[model samples]
Target: MSEPHPASVPLLEVAGLRVSAGSRMLVKDFALTLARGERVGLIGESGSGKSVTAAALTGLLPEELQICGTVRLDGVHYNLVGASDRQMSRIRGQRTGMVFQEPLSALNPLMRVGRQVAEALTQHGTLSGHAAAARSVELLASVQLPDPAEAARAYPHQLSGGQRQRVMLAMALANDPDLLICDEPTTALDVSVQHQMLQLISDGVARRGSGLLFITHDLAVAASICDRILVMRDGVLVEQGATADVFTRPQHDYTRGLLAASDLDATDSSGRLFTVSSAAGYVPAAARKRVPAAEPAVPDVPNSTVSESARPDDGAHSDIRDAEPLIRVSGLNRTYRRGRSSLFRAPSEVHALRDVSFEVAAGQRFGIVGESGSGKSTLLRILAGLDQPTSGSVQVAGNEVAGSRENELLELRRQLQIVFQDPMGSLNPRMRVRDLIAEPLLLPGEPVAARHHAGRVAEMLNAVGLPPDAAERFPHQFSGGQRQRIAIARALICEPRILVADEPVSALDVSVRAQVLNLLADLVDKYRLTLVFVSHDLGVVKHLCDTVAVMHQGRIVESGPTGQVYAAPEHEYTQRLVASSLSLQPGSSLPT
Candidate 1:
């Protein structure tokens, strides 16, 4: 038999692929070709068929949907429009491996991490149990998971988000398949971890000489790693070309809009602002430049910004005298104890936070900006009363948190609420929308009848841009964006004075993210609530926040108004962060 014609035949070929759900066509006439060892990226906003195309490629589409297309891999033709389940299963893991967006759910909770990987390897006939176990360790090491031997014994919940993602990567690479598909693998990760994950994928594909299909909505991320990019909009393939050409000269208006709305800096133009404590020998130049300068004064902006008389003079600081602070923390610290190897050895302590102090005034949208492992979440948890600080005090609505008795603490908790990053995990699967929204009101010492609460829930649903009947659906019945609206309604049910949103919309689609953000801004204004917004995305923070606080290694290095900090950063770390934010300015690549 003739050797497989590598040049004449594509590794994976998708032509005129189309999919629809009921009356709506989610993916329309999508086409692409990938040669062996080539990496291609697919980018689009929510409901643009990016994920649908990915699902079709791996034969994971739901039975309710209709598909029509030609999909071939390694010169073997397969009609995905009506392919059998057995045929698809034979091709899925053996020939094409996929790493899903959520690693936590993708990996089995009951199985050990190592066994999960080994199972894939053994099922593919790549190795026996013993050999596969050893290969699993190697795979884990290849992804740079620390102590692969020990981590193999750990479960999915035991590892951090980044680590679990690495385990997912290991499973995808276990069989050494010719094609690897990664769907927004870094969406939940921090910037540093995201960079590392991309680098790992790039290196692994090169070594195995495999074709890669990367799906994401983040333009900067796709631009950084992909050789070619395909832009999709509303179920249609708008454009496809080299990454540089597509980014430099986008042909479609939707493509241009996506690039513009991404808010990621194309280059590292600004100087460093604050030192990153986790990174060695990383001193920010901006910190050195402020040697002789005096401390700057805060700017004055009215609480409402509605009344001309209430507005301050040009140089006056913003006022919070009459209004109570929504969230307050003084000298807060959190320490985690690492287990000791021997009985005689004392457990090692990890200082997640140290001397963190700040206040978010009522109706003030405050920001906590930081890199990974900088204790941003730790501080948010303390303020939300999810976790107690190792030292220092927390006050919410003038009620002392640390010193309060159990009864008093419960009341204080009612006045404060948090919206976490992962909407899917945050919501309960068994509960319907109405019960989830009414949960906060059902807390101790609250007055909310089923009849009266149903109306309030519906009102909250509408406020978050959801339909009134959305209250009747279950959590999984809605899309990611709609589910987030349910989460928001749950947070607002108690009419809390303070809202701690920890990376709330970061996982959302760009278009959906904007809607959620606008809703948050409006809600904050109408309720006169204090907002502690924690996010790694600097662009979002700049738009949503009135005041900003930069955190590094559990400490606040800089704090001031958003405009002042963005325009002229005082700390080196802050400068780096601002610069790292992707920009669409002419003649610029991704910021270093």
Candidate 2:
């Protein structure tokens, strides 16, 4: 009924943590232990109740949701699970600090970043103006912000995603709480930044002698940060063991499947990616871990410039040299002015993309890989007709992008589609799934009939492996992976010649990522659609893209087949990128 207490009380303890709605249970019988200065990882997929468990520990769960548990932070002697709002307000950041996944949303946009962090300190303790300000700068510096003084003056919007996350970490550690809970903190970050962020968190916690409860869907990240791991599925703890044992010798089927899905080497002996079989509510068996059941028919990276019809099995390495390019760019450049300047000083310009040149062939899976601010999104936006470059010759679907008429631009848009990084931002929550998917089907003068759109929406839902009933529900009702599928379906309804995905799977659960990747590949092959994928994930890019282009400091540093570039990177930046890829596997370490 109760956990075995250590001689010196554990830093945090949970017993019979249960979160439930009127009838549905989100989390059940969840229990965990964390000692001071110890790091633990709670690993699960979306809807596995990992987040809910964290929320319960912090007493942040909604009022409507019923919570029953005993959450105790040693020496505090208060029940965190049943704590009132008044009690939780004092306890939350003071005794148990937390870092959420999205830093921008967590931070107030109008407030200066320094004030926001200082406010966290002022809440639990007393520190006046200059002292708090100085402390804020010190905290930012501790998290490795480039210029702590300048960063303290900047707002949340001014900082990069990675920097914002670092600020969040700083804010969480402001009070030096005994327990630190980080929920998917590095999910949206680039691998290089993610590694640094993890290090920052670890070092910060270690210095404070704080216990850590890291919740994440990424097994490798969990492995890298945590000493112990708890595997959860559908709200129940399937297994609990040391990190090394759980990662390598997982006994639970779900844990094994998760590992298999997260495997960078998720391939058959012949080198073809496995095609996941998805049924209605499909759960992969343990046997499916190593065996490649299906050789996904994909266009292999060509050895030489030739034609479109060549395959890897054919042993003839030919590329689409003679074929008409779907999207072409030459000497592309995009510059932005960040802040206003006085008459005495000139305004600074941020050159996002400089002299970037690349050609995407028809039906080719072209991947653009880079770190943040490396012009990956800028290049993708230019390709999608969303943004313009000052100096470049860009032709989309054989139409000049720079000098296109309104109707001509609309035509180009119809020929090309884009799926943004956050699907929730793109999809309207008020609309039904059918309406969201059918929004693209409506034309300027000719509105598609509701009945016709409904039929099409149902078909698209099925195509993405969602149930037909999902069409009736709202976007909020669906899980993240399902919402992404809906976003993909919406992008496809227009039947664009090209599909542009910007870090599509970066925010998804590892197991769900594989399914979505499989679905994307299937759709690309089925419709013979050219894919322009932009991401920091080299492994994901190499898995899906036939060719890859590496971007660094607003320039094309490397361009070649994914295999070749990964194997032998010519540029210094690219070599660093390849070397800095943070993985659970051996031979990789976070940047110091």
Candidate 3:
């Protein structure tokens, strides 16, 4: 993935690294040495110590975590481990730069983007006044942000996810540090934006001759961006080699499982997607010789119109071909009024959804694929009865929802449920898992007996592949995948006929994403529910959806059978989106 660098003169070196949180060890004796202009990828699942290792290297770990490591930069003579705040502060932006996962949280919401970049410049007294401001815009332009000057004046919330990420890159490269550490910086970005961001990071590192440490759970992304790949699991490095060697010939079982799980093309003879599970000993589907168990332990819930035997084996919805659409939308439009331009001027209108219309038949898996700000979310919210459309007709289960009041949405709400993108944000941290799942059942002016609530919660937990005891825990106590399962359980507790999943697996690791996708597929099939899945990942949509609608700007640019659309996209935007979707094969060429 990169040209060989001279090893005799390494750019940065770390040895005898270990991080501990009180009695539990987070990272154990991790060591690495990077040459100039080298890009190394640290690949791992959530809670596998990948982020912790980056934090330890960058002096960003929490104060309570005990760190014992020897970090030597190209020009630094002192050990970076246990350095005082003053010394570390000087080294942070001047010598080494960090790009965190969530740029929204990392950036100041109140500050203008350009001012933030300028602050990064003046932190080390490198530039000030107009010079710093000019340099900030220059940095933004270097990251390929459209209209850099205008973007500089906008606040972080005003910009899209990709734009905010570009701002983070601009600030990270403000001083051209010798070492750049990026922690899942493109995890939540869409395919095109992620590709652009990766290219920007690569270009920035190359131009500055910096050693790069890119930490992420995405194996294909690592394969594309990094020269060397290091596989980590449970706080231990399992494999390390060149990009081609590690991915093509994985020696470790965990690495092999990760590769298998990431291969969206691979499936069993029965068309069931192959998924890996560390809790089950990290075995691939080929080794196991069986597909994931589609039949969950819980029995079917109420309001199921179709039986499990009527479900399609290959994700086809042939049985619902003659049925009326479960969800119908016509000329859907959502426009938000911005604040007044001036004291007396009229407000600007942001058209989030422009004449969007789609239909999902009962027992069909319908997918919506698009980048951010493409009206996918707005459409989902309208379908879920959470947001009203501006000028359109939205009918779910034969009931109009666009102009319905809160009192008129009881039956619609009972028929439709939503699973959000970020489960951690949606799930109440203070509530127990049981109560969280059962809360939907205890609707307004309706109270169920404690025994019935417990029974329903346990049944949902089993259906989603969670243990019964998990109901006793809180949201914070589970892994990312487990948290999503809990969210799924809650969404299904009432057994809604229509399921609206908004990027449910976008933020998860590859393995966990596979597990969740499989779980969703199985549950959707077994329960014969109508699924309206929204995602930016084209590959995931292609894998899970029988029908797909390609949205761009606020309208559906293309719509057809998933295979037909993916095989031959008609719209220019859909064609570009397909081209930008990243998929890496063994021994395949990577971007340089």
The whole-model lDDT of each prediction reads 0.76, 0.80, 0.83
Which residue window of length 10 is worst by lDDT in model 3? 302-311
Per-residue lDDT of model 3, residues 390-487, tens digit only: 89899999889977999899898889899998999999899999989998887787786545689889999999989999989999999989999999
Model 3: residue 526 alpha-carbon error in angstroms = 0.9
lDDT string for model 2 (167-209, tens) is: 9999999888888999999988887888789889888888887
- Give the local distance difference test score of model 3: 0.83
Cα error, candidate 3, residue 315 (Å): 9.6
Q: Which stretches of candidate 2 lie over 4 Å from their true place?
A: 1-9, 83-95, 108-111, 119-123, 126-132, 268-317, 321-324, 337-348, 427-443, 446-461, 467-477, 493-495, 586-592
Task: Extract clashing residue pairs from model 2.
Answer: 306-319
Candidate 2: RMSD over Cα atoms? 6.1
The candidate 1 region of ten consecutive residues with least summed lDDT is: 267-276
Question: Each model's TM-score?
Answer: 0.73, 0.84, 0.88
